[model samples]
Target: MIVNRRGWMGLGAALGLPVLGSHAAAAAAPRQGQMVHHVFFWLKEPGRAGDREKLIAGLKTLRAIPEIRELRVGVPAPTEQRSVVDSSYHVSELMVFDTVADQARYQDHPVHKRFVETCGDLWARVVVYDSIDV
Candidate 1:
């Protein structure tokens, strides 16, 4: 999902807060900077276009949440390495929240729950990696 200037400001206003100047601002206090969380999903089957659409739609809902710093979604790129082949997974999602607490809240959010309920069956495996910038 794309977040424009006005959109970000609107989100801030909705939360009764000030608008952030950069993506970094949404991640943490200026002194601490931003942290990023990367999430990967392996689908149960291949060629489920309908399910993919639903997933995207669900993600858009997540994007609307003010706590989320950034949200990126896409499929893995094809590669030539035979041993490193990944064929079952259909898509991946990376979401960055303002803080660790925000991430936790997101996990427990109703919208996130709805997304999982609606699209969880389509995935065979899921992995999440989180890191903070030093």
Candidate 2:
């Protein structure tokens, strides 16, 4: 008997193989969470000099928010490798959340917004990356 595409798909499904565009596979896939990290460079201002206190205070305020699973702010340590000496950015901030929705909420949070509004002007460039853990 000749097996068509539909027959092959049904056989695969019966054998518990994932079928493309199937609701079962979609439902079985794991849900991923979000992690947001930023590297900031302050050109006009000194390294962690101007607005440092206020920026730390704002970061602390963000830490107090429940949506933030993890928050860290620091400067990169010098590495021995010559190629690793690119110190263009002075500071970095990393924040992780349980879900993308939590990150969105954190963005809208008063403390986070205040932090950006307060210290954003000091930075010449800010790079942000958001990813989900597998």
Candidate 3:
């Protein structure tokens, strides 16, 4: 069965897996940070292939930024029915950072700024989800 974050935290703690916002987080966050960034872009013109390609290309340029440990960009998966899944977004990016600081730096980096400036106009809505690894 699917479990939510609280349930995951309980399971993680029991299994000695990392849990964010616990005592360990307060004491000293692991130097190898566990910040995850999830971004979904909904295009104003979702029917247009050009908009999708442009955003994909722009996001690829973001891979050159040094702070991100891992970066993945793609469209939604054709998963089976689920209650909480959201697949309406045109483009999605999943980025993992070593720390919150590194993520913050990425937000202000010139290349990131350029990506926004260049491709921001193509989307009708943008949703971002940021989380610490637990």
Candidate 4:
């Protein structure tokens, strides 16, 4: 349960899993000119696992879009509750694109459209924040 780095590497080797090197990790980090699209969903039926799972599954389908560089789907973390922290949303997603144009393409992509059509009723409120490196 308490595996050290070497032990984890050995376990990964035994499992035939590809170890992520520094390069692979760096590839996921945000780069200048890349667009970060962050979305928060407040479910109509908050605290319902089924709805949350359905929304998460729908969000995952967006990864099929070619313009998307990276996609991360998550729920709020159980971090210390502070005035600056907002964990009210039931589900959240962070998508990275090579450029703002790429993100626009993703908005029009069929997969994203389908996701919206199918899962639109699940959330009562949706908020989005988009940014780029300065």
| CA-only RMSD, every prediction | 10.6, 11.2, 9.0, 5.3
Candidate 1 structure lDDT: 0.75
- Across 74-94, the per-residue lDDT of candidate 4 in tens digits comes to 999999999999999999999
What are the runs in model 4 whose C-alpha is more than 4 Å off?
A: 1-29, 47-49
The model with the greater TM-score, 3 or 4, is 4
Candidate 3 lDDT at 105 equals: 98
Cα lDDT computed for each candidate against the true fold:
0.75, 0.71, 0.91, 0.92
Model 2 misplacement above 4 A? 1-34, 47-49
**Candidate 3 local lDDT, 41-102, one digit each (tens):** 99999888799999999999999999998899999889986889988899999999988999
lDDT of 2 by residue, 70-111 (tens): 888776677665775766666667877878888888878887
TM-score of each: 0.65, 0.64, 0.74, 0.78
Tens digits of lDDT, candidate 1, 2-121: 998898889889999966567656575432545577777776765766876776676677786677888998876777757668655567778776678888888888888888898888
Q: Give the TM-score of candidate 4.
A: 0.78
Deviation from native of the Cα of residue 19 in model 2, angstroms: 43
Q: Order the candidates by TM-score, highest first — what do you get?
A: 4, 3, 1, 2
Superposed Cα deviation of residue 82, candidate 1 (Å): 7.9
